[model samples]
Target: MSVVKMKLNGKAVSGDVEARTLLVDFIRQYQGMTGTHVGCDTSQCGACVVHVNGKAIKSCTTLAVACEGAEVTTVEGLAKGGDLHAMQAAFKEHHGLQCGFCTPGMIMSAIDIVKRNGKNVSEDVIRRELSGNICRCTGYHNIVKAVQAGAANM
Candidate 1:
């Protein structure tokens, strides 16, 4: 077992985790942060995406030991002072999700995309970048729209 210490959301956390434990499992099981979901263990599905030191990453593919001393931000961290982030608001405004299984990761990735891609996000580009994330509900059209809208507001 390895003891990993990291900042989860905005709080300090430390735990004794097996070396093979995935960051997603560590976050959910030890930290009780439920917003990070594991859709596929292979990391092809970006449903388990979270921010590690300000960059979006697939937590399912990331080992907990690798994240020691890092800063991890799950979907639960996006809200500040009970206020939703702009991307979160846009997701809700555009009805970008149904069943809501993928919303957390989608929102995290969308915010990252907008931060890097800016407001001129094309639908095709959004779809291309979001290829790794699977959404069974909206068929991606609304998700793209939501990202575009969110990008404009960011």
Candidate 2:
């Protein structure tokens, strides 16, 4: 077994895991950070997205060992001082979610989108950048709107 150490949601955490263990499993199972969901183990769905070293990545397909000493941010990490992150607030206000199965990853990816594309991200860019993330709920009208609104507030 390989011992992997990483900062998870601003907390230092370590685990003894097999090299074949996926980061999603390490987060949810080992670290008990269940906010990062696993919709598709094949990486087809972006439901397992999380921030690793400030970039969004599919944790389901990412190796835990590869994330050793990395900074990992799950959905649970967004809020600070009991206040929801701007993106999360936007999602709630804009009604971006339905069943909420994909909300965590969607929010995570949205934050990354805002960070990479800047605060003034357009609707077209938001839609295109979110191509990897699928929402089987709404037509994504609200999700897009929330992303754009959240981008401005971020």
Candidate 3:
């Protein structure tokens, strides 16, 4: 076994994992956090999205050891002092979610989108950028609205 260490959600954490352990597994199993979903084992879905060093990436395809010493942020890390992150709140306010399975990844990906595209991101840009995230519910109309509102608040 190898020791992997990283700053997760602003807190330093370390865990023993094999070289083949995926970041999603490490987050859900070793770290005991289940907010990061595993919609598909493959990278086709963005449900396993997480922030590594302040950038969004698919955790299901990333090795846990590859993120050693990196700053990783899962969906669970977005809240602080019992308040939801702007994106999460926006999702709730805009009814961006239905089943809630894809909500976490959508919020994380949306935050990253705003970080790269700025607060005034367009609907087309949001739809294009979120292509990797597959949402079977809600048809993305409200999700786009939530992302824009969240970006403005962020």
Q: What value of lDDT does candidate 2 attain over all alpha carbons?
A: 0.94
Flag the better candidate by lDDT, 1 or 3: 3
TM-score, each model? 0.96, 0.98, 0.98
lDDT of 2 by residue, 29-128 (tens): 9988789898978887799999999999999889999999999999999999899999999999999999998899899999999998899999999999
lDDT at 36 for candidate 1? Answer: 90
- The count of backbone overlaps in candidate 2 is 0
The TM-score that candidate 3 achieves is: 0.98
Which residue segments of model 1 deviate by more than 4 Å? none
In model 2, what lDDT does residue 88 have? 99
lDDT digits (tens) for residues 42-97 of candidate 3: 99889999999999999999999999999999998999889999999999999999
Worst 10 residues of 1 by lDDT: 114-123
Candidate lDDT (C-alpha), each: 0.90, 0.94, 0.94
lDDT by residue (tens digit), candidate 1, 6-50: 999989999999999999999999988898998978988789999
